[model samples]
Structures are given as structure tokens and as C-alpha cells.
Target: MTFEQHISGNIEYLERPGSIGGPVLVMLHGIGSNAASFTPLLDHLPRDWRVIAWNAPGYGGSIPLDAEWPLALDYAAALKDFLDRLELKRVLLAGHSLGCLIGAAYAAAHRERVVRLLLSSPALGHGVPCGGALSAAAQARIDDLQTLGPDGFAALRAPRLVFEPESNPEIVRYVRDGMARVSLPGYPKAARMLASGRLIDDAERLQVPTDVIVGAHDVVTPPDSARRAHAALRHPWRGAFTLVPGAGHALYQQAPVAFAAALAALAETVG
Candidate 1:
């Protein structure tokens, strides 16, 4: 595995190179997590499949957006540039939580580059009650983070990310550590994007194969949310809403085996 700066030195990504001619999987971590969050998932995937997990702008050592509070499209533009720099013409894009929103935006604008998309524990922005409600909710998260700080905020919310946090000490640590790594300067902007993102609209515009997978027990973005997002897809029949039993919002971490299996299934269907 290697971490290198790409896209004219604006983006930093963790990569696991595969054999020549093997398919590529570009993984995007959620708001509070970095590319390392997909470490376990990478371990479970086929060794021959190349994997690239990006530390989205504002997280880890990656650069932050120039805007005070950028929109989802802003993030999408960065992702597109990253892909272009890597010379990846087509790829299997998998995103988690906030990454889902950004991925949807990219797929909508650059349909030809994305052959397949997998949204794991997606955070459906517009799927919330109303625009006002979403904004208010997003503001609340920003407020909490600003007040509590990263360590405090992680302490308060990390446990809620997984089911039976008491029984899963390792996962709890993983969640907390990932959240603690979030950049204070970048998080507020990401929260604003999350609250006001047009993920549903973007999903509806997607022309390639898509899948929404959520942990049945996920409270942050529940099964109902995933179903709604799946229903909004332009090709609902071609897409699917899969529920990983007994898992929670941290589905990828809690059930890496099952989550990887789901991803492999999608890859098999890709042309």
C-alpha cells in the first residue's frame, strides 16, 4: 500500500496496486473518516483487484476546499479531477456515508467514467424531511463539533455509529479514532454540504449500475433511508437496496466480510 499526492498535488490517496488489466475500485470514506477507514475492507477484497481509497479534501493530510462552506458539487469536481489525474477512464466507485453524496454528484456529471457505484451506509442529504430540517440538523452537528471539539465530539457520537458498542470494543476504537482525525477547518464545510446536498437528484440522474447497501440496524442513515435513495435511482430495477443484517451505520467496519461479498457481487455484474 502507498499514499501519494495526485491531481496536481491537491489530493492524497492510499492505494493498493493490482496486476495489469485488473479492475480498479476507488473507495471514498465518510465525513469523519479518512482513506484508512477502508483498511479492513481492502484486506477482504481480491488481491488482484486494484484499490484506491482517497482522503477527501479536508481530511487527513489532503487539502481543504477554498470555499467557506462548499457544496456537494464542489467535492465532486475535486473527485473528477482526481480520477482524471490518475487517468482512470472507468472504475467501480464505492462510497460510504458523506462519500455517497459526493459520488452521486460525480456519477451524475461524469456518467461515462463510472461503470458501477456502491453506496454503503449512504447519507442521503435531500432524503431528509425538508431543506430547512436538513439545514437545521447539519447546523446542529457543526455546533456540537465546534463546542465539543474532535475528541469530545467523537466521544459523544462514535458509540452511536455501531450496534452493541460495548461488545465491539475494536470497532468502537476505530470509529472514535477515525472521527478524531477529522479536520476542524474542513468538517464544518462538509457538514454544510451534507445538510444541503442534492443526492437524491444526482442519484436519479445516474445512468450506470448502482447499489445502496445499509446495515439494517443503522440509525444514522437507516434502512428506510437507503430504500428511499434506491427508489430514487433512474434505473431502480437495475439497482438494489441491500440490508446487512445485525449491522449498524458502520456496516463496512462491523461486517467487512459480508460487505466485501456484496461489493464482489456487483463487480461480477459489471461489464
Candidate 2:
């Protein structure tokens, strides 16, 4: 429940020591999500592994970022600076959704410092299907940001991402609150990054082992995109990709036990 949080380049983070040493797991949250959202997975993690979760600029407790900063380049730089500030030379970076985009870019840009990578419910922007509702929905989100600002954008999108229509009201509430807390400027710029981002290409040449976990019922990023990512990795450095059962896009919330099992197993493979 208690841990020392770090600050760098307008981002705030909390680090939890795990049962194993050597490779640390740096977890990143999705757009409109924050460090606190990973609490459930944290419980199921090993104490020996160094676990770090950060609030992306404008989400959680992190300060809002510049509206002009939409490129992954800036985010990748900030992440590098953050790690440098914390004195972590190498880490096992993991992320979900928008966080996955950042994690992939960070790993690719600083291949020397990252030992491995794990992505959950990833939305590989360039790889997202150009046709169908996924494409249409993505466009709609961008349009909404221009029209409704961040609050309205957050209100409209969080539910579709968090749960299915069949989910319980309590679960929906938890997801909604997290999305709602995100500031307007942060959300819009972050969304713009997502709309323009292309992390799968960045992950292609990565030399470290990488794992991708997807929820079978995820409508937001979907399982197909995960499969495409798994295919994109270097042959020898390829990692496992799994689609968890009975979960929507927010697998960490809808089925945290399974998500943790996958995450803990990732820890085991750190060597």
C-alpha cells in the first residue's frame, strides 16, 4: 500500500520491489488511465521483482504536458530521462494501450537499457485495420477531442474501453472515475498521439524478448492486433502472445487474476 514515488519531466510514478532481482518491470497505463489502475496486478506480482508504474503526463498525479507535444519521440525522451533520474540502467518495460505505444517506442529508442518488453491490450495505431468500426471509432475519437474537449472526450470513450454491456455497474464506475479524472489538454494531446502513432514498426527490430497479452473480448484494441504484433517481432527474440478468456479491453480490471498470472510469468522469463 505504501511506496516511494518518483517524478521526472512532469510524470509521477511508484515503484514496488518484487521477489526477484535483476530485471525491473516498468508498467505504463493506457490513455486517460493512471498508475493506480495497476493496483490489482500489483497484488498478484512477486515481491522480488522491482515493479514501477507511472502516471503519464496529465493522468493520475502527473502534471499535464504541453499541448504541442504529440510525437512518441518526446515521450520516449521523457521516459529515458525518468529512468536516468531514477538510475535504472535497464528495465523490463510493460504497457497497456497508449502506454504500450510509449513502452514500445522507449524500448526501441533505448534498446541498450531495456532487457525485455510486455504489452497488454495493445493498440498498434498503424496496424489497426483501416476498415470497419475500429477505424471509424478512432476517427470519431479524434473528432470528439476537437469538438468536446478532454472532459467530454473522456466521458464518451471510457465506457467503451473499460467494459462490455454485460459488466456490473460497480466495475463500470471504477473505470469511469479513472478516465474522468484526466485533464482536458492532456487527454486531447494524448489522443492525438494515439491517432498518429505507429509503435508496431518500432517493435519490429527490437532485440529483446517481448510478450503481448490480449483480452479475447477486448473491443478497444482487439485480439487480432496482438497477433499482428507477435508476428512483427524479430524471429529469435519472439515472445508469447495470449488472449485471456472472459475479459474485455481492460483485462487487468475485468480479469486481473489472469492478467497477474501472465505478468508474474513474464517476471519468471526475465532471464
Candidate 3:
């Protein structure tokens, strides 16, 4: 289900080979997370698709990014290099949270190399600058990032992001423990980028067929923002938005079956 191989860059990944042999699906996790973050999604996956979850530099088992890792473009470049090394010229890109932002940027910049893009908890743009409120929120995240490192962050985040644990405490705990193990420095920078990063103006020109998956209870990136993003795309069909009821931002973990069902439905459009 997982393995380590040296591509141009050292990448830790989870690979679920599909029998159909199309472009390998490239899955990128949100910031402060790793390739293994999508275990739930993998579990629901079928053999017709080769699913690979990539650990962005400094997260999970991937090598650490340079201290001065390129902000947005640098990250995109890494993805480009990564795909090229794997000999996958074009790929189906699925990303969550900050990873969504990264995937969108890549697709927008290299339209020729992307077949489809699926975004979950996407970071379309910075939350409306709510004066001090936004700053306060960001600072709190920064503080937490510093305090929790990987494990603590996971512990704190799982309960909030995943569906109620009384519903399935052990399941939630399993995810939290993995999240908490994420790379330290990678977590804060990811948070910083999402807080101030702007992609709305750029995504206005994205060309690939794209879908935004939103969880109804997602406080991280609300549905209203998703609707705004949906309206902004030049190709509206290329950027559809779907909501997951009774789930939060990490629904792929909280409710993998539903998430896979949605993704499978989207696959039909791609075909």
C-alpha cells in the first residue's frame, strides 16, 4: 500500500495501483499533514486507478524543504519536477486545504500537464481580511503550530476536523496520531501561506475540469467561499462544487466511503 523510492527528490508516498492504467492520480495533502493522510480515501479506492499520495517536502516521511522553500511557485515547481520524474507528464490532481491551493496553482500554470483537479477544503483565497480578527486567528494558528509540532497539532485538529468521535473515537484517534507526527517547520509555513496567500484572481483563468469538495461542517474553509470560487471560474463546468453533509474538512478521513463515492462519480465526467 506504501513504499519509498527515490525520484529526483525523496518522496514518501502511498500507492494504490489501479487496474485500468490511466494517468496515476496524484494526491496532495493539506499543510501539516502527510501522504498517509488519505488512508481512508485509499481504502475506498478501486483497482482501476493508481492512487498515489505524495508527502510535500517536510511533511510526514518526505525530505524537509529548504529553509527558503519557494513560496507558491517553488512548491509548484516541486510538483512539476515530481510528476516529470515519475514519467507522468499529465496527472489527475487531487488536493486538500493548502494542497488544493498548490494543485490549482500547478494546473493553472501548467495547463497542458493536468487532466483533472479535485480540491477538498481548498484555499481559494485568504479569508476576507477581517481586520484584527484575521490576524488574531492567524496568530493563534502560529502559536499552536509552534506549540504542538506534529503530534500535538494532530491531537488538537482531529477532534475538530473529523466527525464526532463518540461516533467513532478510535477511528478519530488513529487519524489524529498520524497527523500529530507531521513535520514541524512544514506545518507553520503551510498555515502562513494559506492565511495570506491569494489565488482567486489567478484561478479565474484555470482551464482543467475541476471540482471543489466541501464538507458541510467545515469551519476551515466555509461553503460560502466555495460558492464564490465556483462563480469565478472562467469554465464553470471545469470547476464544480459539491458539499458533503454531516462532515467536516477532513471528511476523507471522517467518512471515506462517501468521499470515494463522490470522487468515483467525478471520474465519469473525466472519462
Candidate order, TM-score descending: 1, 3, 2
Cα deviation at 76, candidate 3, in Å, is: 1.0
TM-scores of all candidate predictions against the true structure: 0.93, 0.86, 0.87
For model 2 the local lDDT of residue 80 reads 85
- Local lDDT at 167 for model 1: 96
Top candidate when judged by TM-score against the true structure: 1
Flag regions of model 2 displaced more than 4 Å.
2-6, 18-23, 65-69, 126-139, 142-155
lDDT per residue, candidate 2, 1-271, as tens digits? 5456776757789877655445587888988678877776766776667888888876666766565546666677778877888788988788898888888888887888877788889878743422223345455765776687656766676677655644555666667767667775676567667766787787796787788899888898889988888889888878888889777787788888888777766655544
Tens-place lDDT digits, model 1, residues 120-223: 88888744333344476787888889899889989888999999999998999999999988767889878878877767788788887898899989999888
**How should the candidates be ordered by lDDT, best one leading?**
1, 2, 3
| After superposition, candidate 3 runs with Cα above 4 Å error | 1-8, 67-69, 125-135, 269-271
Which residue pairs clash within candidate 1? none
lDDT (C-alpha) at residue 156 in model 1: 89
Q: Ten residues in a row with the worst lDDT in model 2?
A: 126-135
Candidate 2 matches the true fold with a TM-score of 0.86
lDDT string, candidate 3, 65-109, tens digits: 564323555578778887877788777788787887788788889
